[model samples]
Target chain A: MIAAVLLSLWIGSSTSSIAELRHALFSPDERVSDIAIREIRWPRTVTALAAGAALGMAGTLIQGHTRNPIAEPGLLGINQGAALAIVSVAVFSGPLQPWPQALLALGGALAASLIVFGIGRVDGRGASPITLVLVGAAVTALCAGVVSAIVLLSEAALETLRFWQVGSVVQGYDSFLALWPLLLAGTGLAMANARGLNALTLGEDSARALGITAPRARGIGLAAIVMLSGLAVTLAGPIAFLGLLVPHVARRIFGADYRWVIPGSAVCGALLLVVADVLGRMLARPGELPVGVVVAMLGAPFFIYVARRRKPVTV
Target chain B: MSARRTAPTALLLFLATLAVLCLHLSIGGTPIPLPDVVGSLLGISPDPRTELAIMEFRLPRSLAALCAGVGFGVAGALTQTVARNPLASPDILGVTNGAALGAVALLALTSQVQGLPMFLHAYGLPIAATLGGLLVSALVFSLVWHSSLESNRLVLVGLGMSGLCAALTSWMLTLGDVYNAQQALTWMAGTVNGVSWADLAIAPLVIAIGVALAAALRNQREVLALDSDTSRALGMDLGRDRIIMLGLATALAVAATVIAGPLAFVALASGHASRLIARSTVPPVAHSALVGAIFVLLADLAAARLFSVVLPAGVATAVIGAPYLIYLVIRQTRVRSA
Candidate 1:
């Protein structure tokens, strides 16, 4: 997957320098090749990898914590919250700034998480997965409604946000650069808690008996989800299916152990996203398809198959 | 089950709906005094502009709300009954998204076809939207029909279809230039803006079809409320009945979507609400319709007049409905726990 994505990146970048490709690859000067590799291909490749990994990790965390198979960020209202916040910024503000949009998206995501958490926590023992999903669906629908209203009311913002809303990876390198700190922090936390997450799968009572504070573990898991999801949204809009798809694929390959599942999902997610980004770049020639759209087109069928095959899991 | 308790609750609901209608008519940007509005309704007022404004703008808007609401309500109730799941609705079934995609696509493709007669456009949009919705419903039905129609599987398929439709819609928006994209985006979000006399005409006809079909399916749906095997054991043609009920529900959903553009959660939430009020395991269709109409009418009124900057009624419903849904889930959890 990595090689494929790299090859696609090379092809995309070389479009502007088609005449010099053979010389650039084996030249003594090496300046042209260096510039092409560093300036054009590297940022796009890295961002795609990072964004995909973040979403994959986030999806795994949500599925693990909630114990629900279908709980992607998009399905759970996190994406909608982040998208709404970002759109609000793009529409209301003249130019797009990464930090503020990131902060606002983080805020919206956290707010939505809290609401879902609260709803799930109703039994004094957290929400059932089904209830949580329903609540998320409700919140997602509501947020979509509000976002639509805002877009309607503000034409300029709507124009700017349309592409972003479609989930692109081409917001330039700055947005990717801006997301690095959050990505590092989130990934680091999630990796650190892999054992705890695995313990969580044994059921709350059993995990508690095994010396994990179920609530604290859940809280940590929630934090990890927020960070990863926030960073992913900041980098590449709300690409759906990555988080849901990557982790499920990882689980199918690596079994249900969080120790393996978490890292496996991360790698799988990065690869999936990079390949998707590469495909998006190549599919329409010069005018790129957004990675989000590519993933959806690819992911939707897989998701349906997963849904049909699996028995419903509790959150 | 006391008569005294049932009578008062029904009475209260009726009065509340009436009060909401009055509020809808009386309140707007140019607020006519409540008495003048009431007097105009009674044909006693001589103030022609206020009357015209109230009769023309407010009345149709309120009526549209009522019709859409009831349509949504019946659709929701039918979905819940058929699926035996509280979360099931036309929106979840991909009907609304499908309809909206159809309508928006038509509008986007026909940029040159603007300024046509209002009647032509009105008929055109709903027809296109209904076709889109029915198409999706057909796809979903076909995909899930091989298996026993489990509610969970049906919802899962619906969710998948909705995601696909949403992606397609987003892609369409992205492909369009800024102006057309903006228009499509807003329309997808849903608005009662630009509603006209012709639009009103489509509502009544579709709604009539929905209601008549719903009435016809009343007994069959009740049987369907029982488990599939039980319904079948009772000599009902489970497969055929499921198809008919689903078809009718889809029609209601398509109609509501055409009129209101997937007004968020009205169908699902209102059906749930009616079930709660009816205190029955199965949602009564008539009660659901009444509840849906009340919910939509009130929501529309609130959207139009509540805030200084008028939001679309869809936005208002979602804002209010989403949190309430959370509360309901929490409440259900608590009940289950106890």
Candidate 2:
């Protein structure tokens, strides 16, 4: 699915104008279609794919670890944390320098996850699914408040960060090139834990009986969550609904197997985002809607249907 | 159950609310002493500046907060009781987001309608929002009707509906011109800022109607909270009562959302707080009202006075209330584990 999306994006970029496309491919003219493709479309596609996959993996890990069908990076406040951090950086500092924002976002996401995890875990026991969700909601609300405070304080900052906060992909493409290593590391970690995650799903006691250390499994799961969600937020400004939507679609198509579900989610997420981005670009004609808005438009109703249909999975 | 025993708690809560209201009136960038604030309220000295600050600015805002908070608290209580889910609230029932979306849509569609009397415009938004909320509730209730309104499922459905409403709102904003988008965004954040006398007037009537209805069904709600089977066994019309309660709750939620964006966590936190304070199986609605009023009044005051940056009261409540919610969740988990 991801490959198809990439191919389509390439075709879409190339098909805008044959002469411009030829110039972009072979010409020294920086203003031609070739530069647009290589600099803009290519980087945008890569960022979307990386971010979507990371979000997908993160959502899957959250749902699996918590055993909550509704769990997602957004639900757990990771995205809000990242967004808040970015907003702070923009407000206090100036125009967004990419690497710093990414690092700050990563730290913020980790901090939020840890805080939520701590709140969810009471009396030194594993957290309940509902408890985790509610705690996440609370934390997210607080983070949103902080974001609002910052926005209200600085009109310039609000103007600069508002578009990004709303989940646009039009920001510095050059910055994304620097994030490849982080994305690779996170993706690798997530993939490596697929087997452990599979075992961990068979109830903690059963997993322990089968020689899987439940604590170790949970630790690894947390690491995967932090890495994937952090990286995803770094790449795209907290695009919600996709993380929740993609994994469910993957589970339905590929069954409950983690190996399939995880990779399937990544593929579906990438495809969904690319399509959403493309649709966003096309729908508005001259003025483009953000990919995040497009994804929400697509995902919300589907999310509602799935949520209503599924029985609650108690952790 | 002794009225005499309960009197102190009620009195304490009322006094606390009044104190917060007084503090709200007194504190701001231009601080007024409590005595002068009191004088202005009593109409003794009749200071025009104080009157403008109190009646024009603080009064409307405080009233907005009171109305919104009460509406949310009662709505939250009703929702939790009807759904039999501690997590269930107006936001979980999609009422808040539905109202927000409807309001946003109206704002987006109507360009020249901004300067009109706020009451007229406000009425449109809440009505549209309530309709949207009702549509979602009806849909979810029907969907889950086959297998009972499972607490978790109801919440999940509500969350999904919220997301959907939010998406539609975002889409509308994106389609809108810059000014419309700005207005829509401000409305979405659940701010009590810029509320006027007109806004205040609408809320009291809507909230009063909702409160009257909720009060009438309070006994039925309490009975229903004892479990549907028990209520049914007692010859109560459980379904009819549930529908009425749900409608009343949704209406209150819509009215509150219209007055004060979504005001995150108030409905959830206030209802929970009231239940905890009352320590009752069924939520204490009157206590919830007091708590809600106090909570919002304090939140607004904090936003107006405490913060160097002028943050919205909604934002302040979330900052404070969310931590408490987290504590509640963790505490609940511990209890369940034990």
Candidate 3:
């Protein structure tokens, strides 16, 4: 992860040398290289790391609580929820001040996730993982419809959101720093839920027998996901597939224990984003591809692979 | 349930579709009065401008919707029957996304590959899009083919592939300049607004062929919903039938996506809508095609007239389709339990 941070700082549209990177690290504000590295790349790196960690944690919590193999923030309408809120705000108001945008995104994600869960819980039939995913797709389509309607309504708003709508972190550090408080609070809440998440994975009956309050724990876990996913979208743009695949990868490496899975997912998620952002910069050259786009490129294949596996997928 | 599958209901649906189509032509931002529209259609109008609007602009757009709707409807019905799942539509099964990806890839590639051959340039996108849809459908089927073909597995896998294909398309959109991006975005939104006769040239042909193929497979459609073992017992070549059905669906969906972007929910809802309208236990493929045409034509009209802004037909479809999907889950499950 540290190497990834350094690696990200090393590359950009404008090339910088290793010596310049070292100098920027210690001397602080000595040269143009120092400022570019410090002001531009360093903040992006931190934002990527923090946002990735949050998404990873969110995916872990949601998947564990739902006990659904395919339960993912993107697959479950959280991203679309955040996106709809952000788009609505941008369309209604002018350009958003970053702090308030993040808060609204968090709120939207929570609302969307709750609706998805509620729909899934509507009947005994809708509660399966298949229904959850199908409902998520339907909700996402609905949100996309609403979004395009709003986009048609306002050209000025599209101008403001066009690039951001693609999901890049090119806006440097102001929004990233603004997102710090929420990221910290969300992560703290997630780590606290690690033990409870493990209990819920044992099924509701066993979980209650083991003295765990399944509903309250699931609610808290969902709150963590909403906060983390919201902040990530606000910090980055709405990177899909990161939260979907990262936790599964984390579980593969760290086993089923939430104690390890939570932190493991966090590290892996951060690593994936930092690497993706750097790769996006390198792949497209001077015109950098957005990190969210890159994650989708990679994550989609992983999604198919997991779906094709022989192990019977449990809801 | 089978007794109600009569000719009158199907004829009613067909007549209603025509009425909707006629209404779609008459109404828009500037409401052309029904009398004038009828006059233009009958070639008795004195005003050339009214005739021009009816012939050049409105006629082509309406035809595009009608053709695309029929394509998606038949495709959706075929897919749903074969998969034995109401949700089995081109958009859900990754075929639509595959076509979208292929078209976008060509668009992106054309910009990248300067001085490309004129022949390739003219035909590349549609052909590529169709092939892409077929390839993805084949892949999804293969992935889902295990000890036994399962609807849930196919859907789940298709959903994954669809997401990936959509992502790839988005990445391609970002690679180009602003004009291309805007054009692609509009197309992606699934509108028939700017479709020229030239733009829609091959879609109708593909759709016609797809419809013919669907008609040929009508016999197999009933048996498709039966158990695989029972189908095999009935001397049905389950593998061959499934492939042919999948091919037909892919072709239909690809035809729709090529002309307009992947118009969401049309294929999924059309099959079920016809079932409800005709009150048939079996998925009414013939009615589904007509119902699909009606749905998209109405959606296009609603999208154009309902908002000050010209919304995509897809948005209006979702306004109806999303809730319908929710209702499907509840109603179907309730029926099963009862």
Measured against the true two-chain complex, the DockQ scores of the candidates, in the order shown, are 0.47, 0.62, 0.63
What would the per-residue lDDT of candidate 3 be over residues A70-178, giving only the tens digit for each residue? Answer: 7888777777777778778888787677667777778878888888888876656336677788788888778777877777787755654664554344552567776
Question: Number of the top candidate by lDDT?
Answer: 3
For model 1 the local lDDT of residue A136 reads 79
Q: Candidate 2 on B1-338: residue-level lDDT in tens? A: 34465567768887888888888778877888998888878887457888778878888887888888889888888888888777778866567887788777776655434575666554666667677667766776676765658456666667767767776777767665634423654556677777889767676788888877886776787887887777789999877888888888888888888788877778888888877777667666777777888888888877766767767787787888878776766666676677
Chain A TM-scores for all candidates read 0.86, 0.86, 0.93
Q: Fraction of true contacts kept, per model?
A: 0.64, 0.85, 0.64
Q: What tens-digit string does per-residue lDDT give for candidate 3 at B191-240? A: 78777789877889989988887877767877887878798999988888
Least accurate stretch of 10 residues (summed lDDT) in model 1 chain B? B176-185
lDDT of 1 by residue, B41-96 (tens): 88887688988987887787777777788888888888888878776788777888
Cα TM-score of candidate 3: 0.95
TM-score of 2: 0.89
Better of 2 and 3 by TM-score: 3
For A209-298, candidate 2 gives per-residue lDDT tens digits of 888888887888888889888888777776777888888888889987888888898888878877777777777655666677777777
Give the winner by TM-score: 1 or 2.
Answer: 2
- Please give the CA lDDT of all the candidate structures: 0.75, 0.75, 0.81
